[model samples]
Target: MTDTTAFDWRSFLLNWSGEWADSLPGGETRSEGDEDARRARWLGFPPASEERIAAAEERLGRRMPPSYREFLKVSDGWRHAGGFVWLLAGTEDAHWHDNESGLADMFEEHLDEDAGPEERQEADIWRRGLQLDVESDITHVLMDPEDVDENGEWAVYTWASWRAAPPERHADFLAFMRDMYREFHSLRAHRRDGEPEFANDTTRKLDAQVAQARSAALRGDWERAGKELDEAKGYGRPRAAGLGDQIRRLLGQTYMVYFEGLVTDPRYAPELLPPLVAEHAAHSYRDDSTLTFHLRGAGEDLVSLAYATLERVRAGTYRYTAAGPFGTAVERARELARWGGTDEAWRTLIDALPLWEPLGPDHLAPLGWVADPVLGPLLTPERGRELLSTPRGGRTGEAPRPTAGLDPGGLAWLAEPDPGDNPTSYRFVLVEGAAPEELPERLADGNGGGDGDGTVLNERLTLWEARRRLLHGRREFSSYDDRALVAVGRAGSGWSFAFDGDPAAFDRRRFVSPAASASAGSDTRAVVVWSGLRARHGEPFFHLSVARGGAEQYAFTYADEEVRSRGRIPQALDPSRFFGDGEDGAEAERSLLEAVAGEFGVRLPRHAIVNGRLHTFTTRSWTRPPGDGETYAVIHLRGEADRPADDDRTADDDRTADDGQGSR
Candidate 1:
């Protein structure tokens, strides 16, 4: 998609070659010069001192894991020190597509909930693949000459690294690790009062030695680092759990950096960078390094830069669509009008809106995430379009309201059918010409037939007209609410209602509403469903439409039972909260009770009850009003849990331990 007038697709492609640097021979090696520079740049960096490692180990009072020792050997070449990897959240399943060769089968299998055990296992493995993909979260630190010890015994030290935590916070993580180790050691004993001492005597000695060694290493002492590591291991301790793996990965990075430096080709860095960094970061749950380290190693590669830019743009777009403030304001405004709101809060929200000109020349995009019908007045149509074109972050979009307004005297209808008994019910009717004039045509003719004016279309047209008149002059004010419109349907046992299609079902045929059905003069199943002309039993309803070109049959697809049974309705539009309780049938009993208690201005008692039962409703539609007239209410729940016994004693013990650590 083009972003600005200056954007040209062809030019972009031509310029993209610079992004990849130079391709390696047989796609395995980079050119000589770039490789040499990268290696030199990383190797020139200083390695972590042995004394620092020793001191850190001393602080933890445990022998660090082998992996961790390996990591320290190459810590100097750590590429990235930024928190870029750690901040990336959420799984990347949506990125999969049909075009992926090996992954396509896996993707399709995952879509099938009823797939056999083998298929399910395959899908699970696929999920785990995505979950464990090194690129998902990682930091890379290349090894170099400076990473080795004075004796030429190479040690790993991060030089250029990905998956590095925020520079400021890295030290904090060390402290956190140390503290957690102490806690783990405390839990080893498992006394009657709970873990007063270390049950694993070996681990206790290792911890003390490692902590001291690390503390000293942090001060740039090398001689003591080896001594501490050796002494801690002598205590017959197993490897440290969390810290060990990281150390090992770091060591690997150091070795690779040294290896690459020895090699002349620059492509080696790029080739090795992506996978190595990815692997390291993956094992550590660090995501930021995946991007930062690669970028750093890549240097002037324009293709990589473009990709990075694209990622940034995409992230920006996502935030713009999903969590931006403007989108929130729009929704808030809608709620304000539906559920009564203080004028001051409303005005404050409006004033907070960033300035945007309506149809103005400025090229600014609308903030999609934050915009809603409630905040529509603050946004211009142009701005909205701009926001739609922006890239997405790792977040999803919120629901948008329907464009249509509410009509008064509106005859809202819902239909449900029982699967075991009767299956079909009247959904809606589309009549031609006029409502009254079209009714007689079907009944009088031997065949259910219609002329231009006598057709069932007339009846639906008449219904639409009547409803519009009742809802006339209803200017858009409130947000459109899909939740409130569900109850309006007449439901039986089996059939449920939906719009467009449902998402969770394995079969698209079950819920998809063919696009052609909604067009004028169309004759698809949607038209049939909307028309309420025929009541077919359980064999799923189908109809052919000729709106676009040639006619094609459309089917009433069954969606997942959950979506069909109880679609999520936002509580903001529930009428009983605004209108008095008992205004509806026995269903309004809770509202009635709440209203009665509210009159005395006293809070009601809160209780916890577990109602372990599952229920389903074959719903069609709900009785929700348009933005112009609907009301809403906000309900808040609050409570607190009592503390466990011996809380004071526990606190005292923890405090004493902390104090002892500080003194040491």
Candidate 2:
């Protein structure tokens, strides 16, 4: 709420002069000489005497609101009350809205049938309100005597004929005047020459507040600084708003594209203006609304230079000179940009932003430097997205390194010929305090003890042999075979590891079922990590699940670029920190794997997964038609017999079988 009692009307309306119209409706006509005379008076008429106010109120058969009466005492009338209002009525000229505009019948006709009581009442009040403005751009400013508050202030409303909406209601006349004052400042700020520097008492007081706020911001007292700046902005201080935006950017609250202050100081303009101009230019190209660059006189030369540099950046010929403490990081980013790795280059700079030192007392951060000649063109749409999505806080330290768990990239060979081809599409499960040999039995237990039939065979074999068997089955039996080869081994940290080659094994009811049930015992836990390299054909996916004492403690899945989670995932394992826009699928998977490995401190030996022997088994379950009802069966096979017949083997199967020979 505005402090209407303390508002200095003269100080608030200081220097209020602009071009005036030739004439006003129901008011005196103004010639060029009369307009010049009014401009000299600062658009304020002499204060109305108490006798004049009394006569006007007696004619209207009502007393005026306290705020409006107070305003008339300060000035009989005002010109250019806001951007739209042209002339405000003096006490003698004021009249009832119902007797003049005749808008009640039209409003009643257009009112919706489902209009609420408040809306209907508002329309009714407007019909009898006192009209204040004599001329406007299809705008009406009214005060309702029937809606007086405890302070004897009437509610004020402003409606525009072209808006096709209800009139906006203000708490009182003071509030309406405050809004108009703010509008005046807002419009003034956008002028090509920018807002004029005001030396009035109000501006001096607001400037002191802004200085105090800046000191508070420097001291890291953001809350206090924000409150002070907000108060100053409410008073329509342009400098306060600009500094407030700077603080928001520092706190990662907003990514401000345009700044308010003129950057004419030679000390800061060279370092700041390029990025401002580039960002403004980039935004102008992408959006229909173009922003004005508030550069005037000597500052105009800097803008011209910035535009020329931007042209070179777009042509891929711009070079950035590394400087200051972050020179090495800037050089690295420059190199990355040269190769068309725009996202990576931008990320590199973003990572180094926290370490930037101010060139002088006025500098904020490296945020504006993102449009440095070398880096400006790298601000592609995807790079801009990455910038916006980057986490709020500055980087804590270098990314965590994997000490225990398998690098997800290391396992890519299981699905593709090389780790670089695509992210390996496989599921890796870790169960604590469980032996490798017990995995198959636990899985069989979860599968209802294998159909209660003797034909459900289980035999131990090497990991390589199991891989051959799975491949042979898929090629010779069914390309979409439901069979899964579960290779059990010992992972670091006393946790048992199970590697399932099937892409769909991440399903809770499939391979994860046994681990979930097995870890149900006292003091046991299970963790599963999966990556689906669907980016080769479509969108990529990643999933993580943690279970303890038979209950799922955490479950997270990132599919189709959206995240879904149940329970709390550890902060260290958050996938968002590792993911980036336009990131390669394999690189993204690798980064996620590293985070999980660092969090859990567990690792799987690469040799064991690809070549070494381990207790491996093939598990499959399906339903068959029965004469009476449905018959279900489970097949748990192991050893060389699990391999498909030689006559039915494909060329890939022959290769896999040959690879398994020495390991078995």
Q: List candidate 1 segments past 4 Å from native.
A: 1-365, 368-403, 406-411, 414-664
Q: What does candidate 2's lDDT look like per residue over 1-664, in tens digits?
A: 4546566677655544432221122244666644654647466788899999999999999989777887888888887787898788889778988836667676777779998877775677667899998889989998888787777788988888788877899999878877886676555434443323444444577779888776555444545767888877765676666566555543434355344563545555655555555556555673423433355543566656666766754443444543564657888976554322344555677666545555555444445545554455444444333333332223233332212222242333443445542325666677888776665554443342122221233333344455555456332232212334666666655677777644443332222333465577787888877678443444577778888888888877777667777888788777667566876666666667766667767666553354333445544321111222212222223456575333333323323322221112
lDDT value, candidate 2, whole model:
0.58
Model 1 C-alpha lDDT per residue in residues 557-594, reported as the tens digit of each score: 22221112122222432332423422322223234223
The RMSD of every model to the true structure, in order and in angstroms, is 30.4, 17.5
Candidate 1, backbone clash total: 134
TM-score of every candidate: 0.16, 0.46
What C-alpha lDDT do the candidate models reach, one value each?
0.27, 0.58
**Highest TM-score model number:** 2
Best by lDDT: 2
Model 2 misplacement above 4 A: 1-42, 99-125, 161-169, 181-209, 227-239, 249-257, 261-356, 359-362, 365-664
